[model samples]
Target: MNTSGGAAAAGRAGNSDALEHLARVGLIALGIVHLLIAWLALQLAWGGGSGSADQSGAMATLAEQPLGKPLLWVLTVGLLALAVWQLAELTRKVPGLRSTGEERKKAVTGTVKTVAKVVVYVFLAITAFRFASGGGQSSSGQEQQTVAGVFAWPGGRFLVGIAALVLIGVGVYHVHKGVTKRFMKEIDAAQTSAGERRTIERLGQVGYPAKGVALAVVGGLLGWAAVTFDAAKASGLDGALRTLLEAPFGKALLTLVALGIAAFGVFAFFRARYPERT
Candidate 1:
């Protein structure tokens, strides 16, 4: 054992309880955002004047409400705190991966996941800031522009192809994770009642696959972009959601997925309630 590393980990552990609660609040905020998205999706399903039904759209809708700026500011702070919490987690040692190879592999994978989470939270924080400041832009438009710009570069097609493949893989992983109930491993058994665990599991069974389907749709769009060399085809979440609108029985499908996403939001609440701080 490295003494310095051990000491650092111990110091982090001492503060984990407090930070964990803060992270829980952040998770709640995340759930709220997803719930809003689900509502927008429902409206779209009913041919109502729903906005984009993605994260930016969600942010835009929030900005239109009373005291929206203050709410966004609060969300930003919570998200930042969550990012910091993940940072602390990235530094701490894994408890159960005792074998050298297992530990190394687990550490690397964990770090990557934590880092990805940090990026996501930070991006959301920035998005909130943008919306609060009245400078929000269309996420799909930006995504298309970004993809177009990427295609301008040498080997950009290859890069875009790689990204598409990665997203596809991630989508598959999420579906598999949901099917296998692997996410339950993150729950603190001591903190969760049997009923609560069952509820969380059931919600996750629907939620994860719904999210996976959305991701897979987005990946297919990106793949289409690569194949046709048309960056406009590589629209983000908004495009994927809208694409569902064009399909046969689209409204019903969209509504079902929206509810699944809402279930995910509720699942996040349970996760916040019974987090296993590793």
Candidate 2:
């Protein structure tokens, strides 16, 4: 009986570890998908037309494209999945309140992060659906209509700008908590070696800057568009790139920015593959 019990316990332990590993992999995959979407959004925001010969304006150009609709749906589902995975990880890591006050504080932080993640995912889904449904006015017919008629309502740009700000704030708070609270220590404890610690730290560092830059660029563009009531002028990614290119030093700067964003995606890919040994 004792021997049988030990074997069962070991099996359960192995299964639990595998589940955690799978959850981590899922989270990483979701992150990569998001980064890819960001890159595509950036490419479109730049001077690259949707590769279509249509007379459609910029919005229509993006909407009518084959990749646009699929990308939108992919992002929507991926973000929701990410949110769920994050919450699950938090629950697994902190199944209950610890006796120590510090542990309790960490639990609170995790809860806040989970909530923030849910909000971001919800808004992202809405944005994706709006884009996919042709409600965003990116089609040729919508483009031919008055720009005022489409952009005047302050729907797309305004909501996205607000969501970006919230995401940035949440990301910053999480990073701060991670560093100050030494949350990575928990991860390190689960890891086997010092090298794993270094790897996880590097991933965290890269993630921080990427999230910050994305938030700032998207948020700033939306805010500017909302105030100026210029939907065409306020579009994300492309508009920002266009503004940069129009400046005397804009082209060079835009190139560097694009490369930096792409590099982030590359970094994400690496992190996802190797991940932290935890």
Candidate 3:
């Protein structure tokens, strides 16, 4: 047994752990914020209307708030950082060609993920900048501004929605690959105990579905909104949740969706702690 190889593997694992931890924490925080925003959107949508007020509107209330811009900027920066970290990890792994065919497969998967992250980060950065700047002409012939930027722009919204859908699709693929391909082999290769393998598999099974669903729902809603020129309808978590809530049986559905998202966050945290198993 080459102790040097084991030590190097351990070091790589540690670095992977740290990066995964950061990603998980960021995602969980984002989810909580999203839920809070959803609640706010709900209030604005259902609360009694003022004179000619469109209570079911997404931007109507958020546009008046001061914290919106700051929040958007924070999210934009955080997502970009995550993208960079993912890309760096992929690059580091790429140069080390493996003799094992499975190891090579994992590297390829990781590379694909890195490329996707880069694209996502670019889209998010552009959208965030557009939101920070005034987006379009207002009734007063001044640029209209919102914290999250052009909740109203069909083009931008559609692009973002497409990006989100791609992300969801990739996440689903990862779930499949992680479960059926990567982690199972790890368990076998380690000669791990059955109980440990089961635990690891369970985590993968649960976490992936939650992630897939959240991404899918978010993407679908955004895309639909874009097509209808109802970009304002899904501007934020609050707006998206409000759209669900306003549906028939929306209140109940919203509760389920919120719980699902929160569960996904928790699962993501667990996955980060045991990335090797996942």
Candidate 1: residue 19 Cα off by (Å): 2.6
Point out the higher-scoring one by TM-score: 1 or 2: 1
For each candidate, what TM-score against the reference? 0.90, 0.49, 0.47
Cα RMSD to the true fold for all candidates: 2.9, 9.3, 9.8
Q: Each candidate: what lDDT?
A: 0.82, 0.50, 0.49
Off-target runs (Cα >4 Å) in candidate 1 are 1-14, 93-100
Instruction: Tell me how far the alpha carbon of residue 274 in candidate 2 is from the true structure, in angstroms, after superposition.
Output: 4.7
Indicate which candidate wins on TM-score.
1
For model 3, where is the 10-residue window of minimal lDDT? 136-145
> How many pairs collide in each candidate, listed in order?
0, 3, 3
Return the lDDT, model 3, position 89. 60
**Which residue pairs clash within candidate 1?**
none
Which residues of candidate 3, in runs, are more than 4 Å off? 1-85, 93-109, 115-161, 164-204
lDDT leader? 1
Ranking by lDDT: 1, 2, 3
Off by over 4 Å in 2: 1-81, 90-109, 118-211, 225-234, 237-248, 274-278
Over 127-170, each residue of candidate 2 has an lDDT whose tens digit, in order, gives: 55666676754332232133345454557545545654664475
Model 1: per-residue Cα lDDT over 1-278, one tens digit each? 69668658755853667767777877887887888888888888888855788888888889889998888888877777788877777556454233478777887788777787899898988998898888987585888889999999999998999889878877887788789998787678678788888898998888888888788888989989999999888988778878987899898899888998898889888878887755
